[model samples]
Target chain A: MTLRAASTAAADRARIRAGEHTGPTSGLAPGLAQANLVILPADESLDFPRFCVRNPKPCPLLEVTDTGSAHPDCVAADADLRTDLPRYRVFRDGRLVDEPTDIAQFWRSDLVAFLLGCSFTFEWALAAAGLPIAHQAQGVNVPMYVTNRRCISAGRFDGPLVVSMRPFAPDVISHVVDISARFPAMHGAPVHIGDPEEIGIDDLAAPDFGDAVVVGADEVPVFWACGVTPQAVAIQARPSLAIFHAPGHMFITDRHHDDFDTGESHDHP
Target chain B: MTLRAASTAAADRARIRAGEHTGPTSGLAPGLAQANLVILPADESLDFPRFCVRNPKPCPLLEVTDTGSAHPDCVAADADLRTDLPRYRVFRDGRLVDEPTDIAQFWRSDLVAFLLGCSFTFEWALAAAGLPIAHQAQGVNVPMYVTNRRCISAGRFDGPLVVSMRPFAPDVISHVVDISARFPAMHGAPVHIGDPEEIGIDDLAAPDFGDAVVVGADEVPVFWACGVTPQAVAIQARPSLAIFHAPGHMFITDRHHDDFDTGESHDHP
Candidate 1:
């Protein structure tokens, strides 16, 4: 079956909600936007939104669900945050407690859901522009590192930035940059290029998270602020409770890739 | 004296702080950024920030001061919000009670200050590109109107969008758009072009606020989401008390026009 017939975002979400699909959401909804999910209690909600605003590159927020509401009206229609995503990683007091396909039992009226922009949107853009994405090509997770650069502190949320790396040829760097820059809603442009040491990445072969890939001799490593930063930071903050999507297991939305074009005039306030 | 020497943003702010200047900040601090100010009580602070995020084009937030802090660390250093702006308008129970140069007596320990991006930044870009800003040329405030478009509500803050208009030649519309889009932090790009009635403006000559300038026969009236929107919405919400900079009398910042370039990789989170 073709990609569309095999699994549209809505279909994938329906299957996931029914507990039929519990794997990572990558490649399931090819041209649709997938989001990084963060659910926190009302008491801890204020600081986290500020955290997203201060560190926009790592946490480009797509839609912040109303306090205690699971419906993300801005990015998705008629979707339930509690049961929509494929898998969830629940943390209590910053310790991983559960890995569940659905969080219905844990849902509370005080919970606030933050749907952050994921790199998958830009990854599609890169692939369309004919740029190689090493991790996807190799069928492995993108290499992520903990940089020495500290994120601007908001309330109790404070940590170093986490970045994902992809190696690209020197000549195509501009093309890659141009294509990715169009989706500021996604991580936007590369944070660091060429020098891993400058951002405190001690070694490329050993990554903090995900599998490291081969860096071609003529290729330069481009690092973009990863969505993992907020999840990691939220975990570090050790709030009473925090819930997020499993790495690579994103929450798919109704929005298409073209909906995020930066060229479109954002005239409404 | 030259424009730079005659009035630097820092110097203009200092003069305003000492009550030496009380007039509109226009034509002063030519190349620096000026910001619209909003001060709300801590009880109402949470919803306002979310409102800004939901309606970014009209309410591009520059800096959100820490609760009860008069300093906006992101945009200015050594600046006091209570006394820095040329003038401030105070509203109590949604009614304008006072317009003062200094708000020290009105300051509360629970107050939160927000500095929003202003369209003046883009207007300067247009002027530098030799595009005529009719209102500026005629020495009057740009015409502003209420539009049919309703802003996404966040808590109690909800109202129709307010837009400012500028007439540009049809041939240079693309050029004007190109220059303005570079500063998304400022009100970037026009929301509507060539049609005022479509957006609910009954007549271009009769504006809701500010002075209306002549639209040339060959010119197309372009409307941009105005910074006045948030303030108007905030006032309509009728909190216990709200404070904001008077129209045209803005709070000057230390940042130069170039610091807000949209091309930079914003990967802070």
Candidate 2:
């Protein structure tokens, strides 16, 4: 089956909702926007929104569902949050408990779902523009790190900036920055282009999250703010209860990745 | 004294906070970022945020204070919403009733303040680039009109798009689009450059808000999404209570108007 037939975003959502498709969501919805999901209680919603505002590179918010309402009209028009995603990681008091294929058991009337822009949105843009992604080519998860720079604190949510790394040749780094910057809703521009140590990563080989891919002799490492930020911060805060998409198992929006493009006109706003 | 010296932004806020300056804030903060202010009860906050997300050009949100918080940390760290601005227009059930300089009397613990980017932020850039502003040149407010275009509605905040008009010579319309496009946090680019009737405005001589300016023979009238949208929509909803910066009065932010540039790398994203 072609990628399209093998991975239907709507179908996958249905299967996940039915407890059938319990695996990573990457590569499932080829052109659709797959998001990093963060579910938090209503009482602590203020801090999470502030955290995203202060660290937009990682937490470019796409749509914020109303408290106790599972639907985000803007991004995923009709999807149900409690059981639409393939998997969810539950956190209690900032500690991870169990990874569940569905979260209906954990659903609460006071939860607010946030759909954040993910790197995958820009990756598709880059690939279509003929930019090579080394990690994807190597079939490995993108490398991530905990940076030395602290995120601007918002109430109880505060932690080090988390970044995902992708290696590209010198000239290509600029191309990546130029392309990714256009998707401000999806982390916009690269936070740092070169010198990983500058941001406090001691070794690229030992990533804090995901698998590290090779950085070619002529290639430089490019970093974009990661969506894991709000999650990491939320988990750190140990809210009474929180839920997030398992890493790499994102929530798919009805919007095609390209549909998210406001084009040059969007750059104006 | 010239408007430049007399309109020192820092001093204007200082005097306003002290109850000495209680008039329009226009031209008072010269080169600083002045915002359109909207205060709504907490229950209505989500719809307004969605309104901004959908109609970004008219409502490029710069800062949204947490529900009930008087401080907008990103815009003005120490400014108090209750007393900083020169004037406030209070609406009860969507009808304007009181125009007060201080909102301390109406302050509520569940109020949410939204600061939207205003066109004034880009006016300084246009003049610096040698583009003439007909309204400013004539010592009048920018002419605005209600357009036929229906803004992408978010919940109960549905309304027609409102735009401000500026006449520019044919040769300079493209340049204006290019310069203003940089400040997305400010209404970035012209919504319509040449035709007035196309967007449903009947005459250039009459305006929905502010004063009309002369359109030279070689000039074309340009329309941009206006900040008046939120206030107009709010009044229509006639919420139990709403407060906004009176026309020509705005909340001055610490960010220089130029700091919110989004044009740097549009080609890639």
Candidate 3:
């Protein structure tokens, strides 16, 4: 199978819905905003949104669908939440049940879906600004680790923060920060810049999740709050039922990544 | 009778608690952040926070208290929410019931309090940058209007967007914008720049709320999403019981105004 950038978000999602695109959505629909999807029962809906609000860096909420509704009206027009994503992970009582291409069979009227902003939007910005993405260059997944920092607990959601890492030359870190900071809807800027041990990462080559990449002698490991934090928290909380997009496979929204640029509008975030 | 700047936030709040201070909290504790307060029952708790998240420009939430608690631990350390402000307005089923200095008698275990960032933080930034405040200079309230723009509805809280007007010299508008844009927690930047008619303001002399300030011939009227928006929406929604700080009698937080400068820490917002 050949990997190519789809020209339109609608077309890309159509392919995913039709089962023609089942691989990771990392580079598909290049300029479109990709989101992490989390579906929970209505019983847990109130606390979950509050959790996202309390820990915004790791869980920047884009749009939360009304209970039992599959449409995320804020980010996309007439998009179905249950079938838009490439793949999904279903958890029963906090344990991974299965990874499936479509969740329409498991859809329940009591479920609420939350669309969270992903770092891919800012990665597009960083790459456009000439910053190299280590994982993409190495043809592997971005390194992720469980940080020592704990997210503020909301109801049943509580866990350590998770971060994704990218190595950048020391001289260009400031430029990298500026470009990424403009999109707070996406994980805004690097949470930790220089040292890995300070954030409780024992080694860069051994990421808790994703593939490891080489860190140059003069490069610093930059970490951004990952959308995985919320998923991890949801798992640890042991809710009776929960659903999330499989890692690296995201829901593509109609909004372009640059549409989230700060100061463009008052309500972007 | 002299409205001198209190030496510190703690001192200012103490004076307000003791009834020694009854004037508007503007400039009372220079450099400190002032907040707009809203207290609602737990039954309406879930939707109110969602409303703030949806319309961040008009209702940039600073801190939301634990259910039934009167303390805002994030913004001010050990500050009592019930009696710390100079005045409060009580509403019963959306109608004004009473104006009280302390809401101790009305406090209930099922109530939740939200502290929203106020324009005073950015107004301080504007003054520090040497931009004149028209209302303060003229000894009147800042002009505010209910625009035709409707805030995205969250649960039952739905209403038109309310904006505060500040006239700035055409040449200095950019400087004003640059400074205010840095404080996203405090209604960052102007929503509209010049023509009020564009956002549906008919008469400049008459505003839906607040006193009208003069719009100099060479000055452009800059409008920012007002903090009063949530209060207006709450009133319109008509929750069973609601409490809010009286107009201009804001709650002062220990954090300095500039402490909310963007990109400082992930948890600030």
Candidate 4:
């Protein structure tokens, strides 16, 4: 199947819903908001949101669907979560069980869907400022590292913070932080910049997830909280069932990148 | 037996904890943050926070304590919910059954306490700007009304939006909105202004909660989302057990009014 970019989120979702589009949503619906999806049973609902609240940097909550409901109330009123995304990975007991285009077969009355802001929005902000994105340039996944920092635990959810790295010149690093920090709903600002070892990231050449990029001699690698943290933590809890959007496949919403902008420009952890 | 203001929030809570101060927290801990407390059983916990997330104007959730844990993790890490507040109201199936200074006996392992941002923060912001609050001037409660507009529901927790009225000159109404709008965590901006009838407020002389204040001949009434909203809505849910901070007996936190300030000056719903 060929990948295509649609002019609008509605168009993109419609194609994906009808099974005409089954590719990653990276460039589709260019300006509209894209979210990382996490569906869990109602029993685990409270602790999950609490986990997001406690570790906002890693998991900026966009909207949470009502228990057992596949339709979102805030992000997109009419959009159905079960079929809106291009792909979903179903996890059973922390292990990947299946990858499906539609989750209607697995929808349960006790399940709740949580939509979290993705780093894609802030990447637009950085790209708009002419800051080159390494992964995009290299045609590979953004390098992500599991850090030594443990997120504030809420009930059954607790794990090491995961951060994605991007190297930039020292002088432009402040500008990069300034641009990204304006969107808190997205992964805002860097967690560590100068020394990767401080955050337990021993080597930049090898990353736990995604492809690693070479750092220029004059550039320091900057890190931002990744959306993968919640998925990692949630799976670490070993819940009986969990569902996530496949890598690069996200839930598209009508909201745009500017919708997530915060007034504060201060770098957030 | 006497109500007195303290120099700081810690001092005020210390007195309350020791049973030395059992009065309204209005003037005590002047600059510190005061929150509206809501405790619900585990079954109702998921919907309650979802309700707040959906209706943030009236219920900006500051923190949600872990189930059965008296120690708050966010608003005040060491503060004990069972005894820190001056007073608490315990409800059974929506009926008020007990008013107590200490609720250690009622504490259950399944209870989850939610701390919501109170209007007291923005009232300070308004007062700091020399805005004369009508109720403060009249030495009466800030009049509140149940609005015609129902809030967006979040399974099992749905009710009308409640708003508190403050009369201000039309000339400075925009400024008032701008100032309070800077604190989205506090009920940011007015929901309705001018005649109250538009929002189902029929008589200005009578209010659903708090005492009524006379509107001036030259001033218009500005209605802000009130903290009473969550209490009214939560009780309406008829949860088997619910606990709240009694009127004027809020849970004081170490954070101050300035801490709630947002960069946005635009009025929010």
Q: Is the docking of candidate 3 incorrect, acceptable, medium or high quality?
A: acceptable
For every prediction, compared with the true complex, DockQ reads 0.26, 0.23, 0.25, 0.20
Q: Write one digit per residue (lDDT tens) for candidate 2, span A1-269.
A: 23463257668788888888788887876788889899988876766766776666787777777678888766665689888888899998888888988888888898988888888889999999999988889998999999998987777888999999998888777678767766677877788878998999999999999998989998888888898888899899889899999999889887777554534432221
Give per-residue lDDT, candidate 4, residue A70: 90
Q: Looking at model 3 chain B, which ten-residue stretch has the lowest summed lDDT?
A: B260-269
Please provide, for model 3 over A36-110, each residue's C-alpha lDDT reduced to its tens digit, 9 standing for 90 to 100: 999999886667876776677898877777678898877777678788888999999999998999999999998
The candidate scoring highest on DockQ is 1
Going through the candidates in order, what fraction of the true interface contacts does each contain?
A: 0.03, 0.04, 0.04, 0.17
Candidate 4 per-residue lDDT over residues B4-87, each given as its tens digit: 332366677888999999888898888777899999998766788788877778988777778788877666646788999989
Task: Give per-residue CA lDDT, model 3, range B163-195, as digits (tens).
Answer: 999998887888787678777778987888888
Please give, for residues A1-269, the per-residue lDDT of candidate 4 as tens digits.
Answer: 01233236767888999999999999888877799999999886668888887777798777888778898767675689999999999999999999999999999999999988898998988898899988898888899999999998998899999999998888787788767766666877677778989989888889998898978898888898999999999999988999999988999987877655544221211
Residue B210 CA error for candidate 2 (Å)? 1.9
Scored by Cα lDDT, where does model 3 land? 0.84
Which of the predicted structures, 2 or 4, would earn the higher TM-score when compared with the native? 4
Model number 2 iRMSD: 5.8
Rank candidates, TM-score, best first: 1, 3, 4, 2
- For model 3, the stretches where C-alpha displacement exceeds 4 angstroms are A1-7, A263-269, B1-7, B263-269
* Winning model by lDDT: 1
- At residue B62, candidate 3 shows an lDDT of 71
- Compute the interface RMSD for each candidate structure: 5.7, 5.8, 6.3, 10.2
Candidate 2, B158: how far from true, in Å? 3.9
